[model samples]
Target: MEEAPKTLAHQIGGIQNDALRFGLHGVKSDLVGSHPLDVAHRSTIKTHEDMKRKVLANTYGSAFPLKMDLDRQILTRFQRPPGPIPSSMLGLEALNGSLDDFGFEDYLNDPRESEVYRPQDMHHGMEVRLGISKGPVCPSFV
Candidate 1:
């Protein structure tokens, strides 16, 4: 019947409008959730340890012992070489100039050149090669 087709058209139009309304509402909900206030609220529940664990886990997986050992090796590699006070550190002017030439500024500026520069891909590949199973372990590793 003509009336039945008209009714179906109206119903379809109403459903389409409802879907558009729902989509717009979803965008609005996402906007509110991403607001600074909501972000701060979410961050407040996370502690320093949680952040550190996330960083370490992301960079080194769950291998804490290996990660710690690698960190120690990197640190030990950067220790200052043993030597006597050079002529550069003798006077105030010389001391200032020597301090300027100590390379700390360069080190701070270009961290990528640091001894501990571990690429994410390399770390993940190394972890896989080490036979560390991904995700939750079974009763065997336990």
Candidate 2:
């Protein structure tokens, strides 16, 4: 490829930092005209230098530790549901201090009002019952 004649333009910003551009050219800076604007540029140059140092520190200085982290494996245990509380632990429980003993002598709370049907109370299974529908039982058609 043939290269064209290059023209230098005064950059408004201090320095251009691009990987591709830095790769192609060494480093680009446009503090041209050797009049030495030292007083005006001293702060700007210091700021740029500080930024460059910070970037270099972050990029090169702060690298992954050379020591292999092979021992950095974290071992996590599998949690399981706890077993049933023992008889001794029952009394120690905060919610229910002690369990009540349940018993049924007659089994029925009141035999007089019991709903169980006896032989004398039987209706001879004469109650009319509806058959199951084969089609949809939607109420919209009805």
Candidate 3:
């Protein structure tokens, strides 16, 4: 109930600029999702549309018929960071067998993910690992 305004307030407010004003949307006086917006927007909703629907329903009331085309364009523009990032890491974990294991390795090489971790068949001019820790996070585990 708290989120309804935050998600679509801009769109709802935009109603003034356009023609059809749906009722006032719920302003995000508080969190109404699986997570908070700062963290949720990053960790939870992975895509623009996902964020849009989540916010819209939380903010205003309905997900149908956004206020205007510009709203949609803005919503669609945001995108998840490259898949190769998680894929590269998860791929290793998944391959390690059943321990910290889950997810598809193919996903790392998937077009959606960056090409840094290219398909086995593909060749790269260079291979550089970034932001990876050399030692285990948990000393005991290492």
Candidate 4:
């Protein structure tokens, strides 16, 4: 469980680094996937067509066309951080890398009952609900 956040941080850092690299090399946003302007134009045309069909009830009848916003989708899928990448660390400080005395065991059984939601409650709750004290040592269920 502790490794999950660290692994995610590593992956996110790699992606951020790649974006920085692409930005530094002058990768144009318009060139990514399809051109946004072109996609918007096509979407406008499709919307007009759908509107015409709905009004006339020629083929689809009164059913409205369920069309996705292609332009917005493309922009969202390829959005880069605006301006230059910051020299300072982004938001990695929230992870364990920044904490000096952060310990995982504290979450399981902490002295501050009001401050922390102990995992023992969840463990005992599940045991009570399932009518079992502790889980089996091996893969006995399978």
Candidate 5:
């Protein structure tokens, strides 16, 4: 008689089976809906990058790692439902201005916000003060 193959789950007392089930649940959760800004991938990287820089320039260079409210506006524009691109979002001039100035204006301040502006770190002397000067620049991978 031929013996049946044992699953890793059986050998490990069902832990592997539990882990696989957990992973499948996570995948199912992802399929339930598209996440905000996921539609941005349909746009070219050049479009996104230009949009990001335009955003930063208008915010006087303070908008990188965008805040929640700004994130929502970008999401809404990219996910516009089955229609022509909005007139306000349609030209070279639009790219030169902030979204707030162009009619998609809901500038809600996020309840959780942090300042991202920092002066350039021109000196290497701080490395010694932080006790990291002696650390390996790249640790040996092996």
Candidate 6:
């Protein structure tokens, strides 16, 4: 039995001139235009010079950073909510007096009445007797 070739050779055929396959023209152009020999270096130098000018202007001229008095400015620009009218101010006192007339103080002081008003028994009975279809049980019942 004969042994097969160990190295693989890719064949690029159909070109009339084999010399055209070497890419000599592209390689020559790349060498000539490589970084140190091209317009890229000149452009970088010009950009650095422009940056230096901007830095000098900001440091020595009227282009300094801004300082603002935020509290004074915001206070001057802000609008306050309208003040309460005299009738509304008097209404608060009348409401407080009415609570006193309603015996709210006596109710608050009674120990028997101190228990939270809960209707849990009513809620459980509704759930057992009426089922879920009847709307939400009153929050007072919960």
Whole-model lDDT, model 5: 0.40
lDDT score, candidate 1, position 123:
36
> What are the per-residue Cα lDDT tens digits for candidate 2 across 1-142?
9887696654322233322222222322343443467766787977875776577567767442221122122111222222222123432232222235343523546333345412221121111011121211111111
Q: List the candidates' TM-scores in order.
A: 0.18, 0.18, 0.15, 0.22, 0.17, 0.19
Compared to the true structure, candidate 1 yields what TM-score? Answer: 0.18
Distance (Å) between predicted and true CA of 48, model 4? 2.7
lDDT of 5 by residue, 1-142 (tens): 9988775322221232243222222455456776557766656666986787677667765555355446557644542222222223443335444533534233665222325322222222234234434221111100
Off by over 4 Å in 6: 1-37, 62-142
RMSD for all candidates, in order, please. Answer: 25.9, 37.9, 23.9, 25.8, 20.3, 37.4
- lDDT of residue 100 for candidate 4: 51
Best by TM-score: 4
Candidate 4 global Cα RMSD: 25.8
Best by lDDT: 1
Q: Give per-residue CA lDDT, model 6, range 60-115, as digits (tens).
A: 76342121223334434443222211112333334224334555546567432335
- How big is the positional error of residue 113 in model 2, measured in Å on the Cα after superposition? 99
Q: What are the lDDT scores of the predictions, listed in order?
A: 0.41, 0.32, 0.37, 0.39, 0.40, 0.41
Off by over 4 Å in 4: 1-9, 12-16, 19-24, 27-40, 52-60, 63-142
Candidate number that wins on lDDT, 2 or 5: 5
**Model 2: which residue pairs collide?**
none
lDDT of 2 at 107: 58
The regions of model 3 sitting more than 4 angstroms off are 1-66, 85-142
Q: Write the per-residue lDDT of candidate 3 for residues 25-122, one digit (tens) a residue.
A: 34462346444568865665457656766676677766443553345465444443333232234333333233454447544654444443232211
Candidate 4, poorest ten consecutive residues by summed lDDT: 133-142
Q: Which of 1 and 4 is ahead in TM-score?
A: 4
Per-residue lDDT of model 4, residues 1-142, tens digit only? 3555533322212232233222233346436677789999999987986776576565654433333233334434442222222122322332213445466645775333334322233433344335454332111111
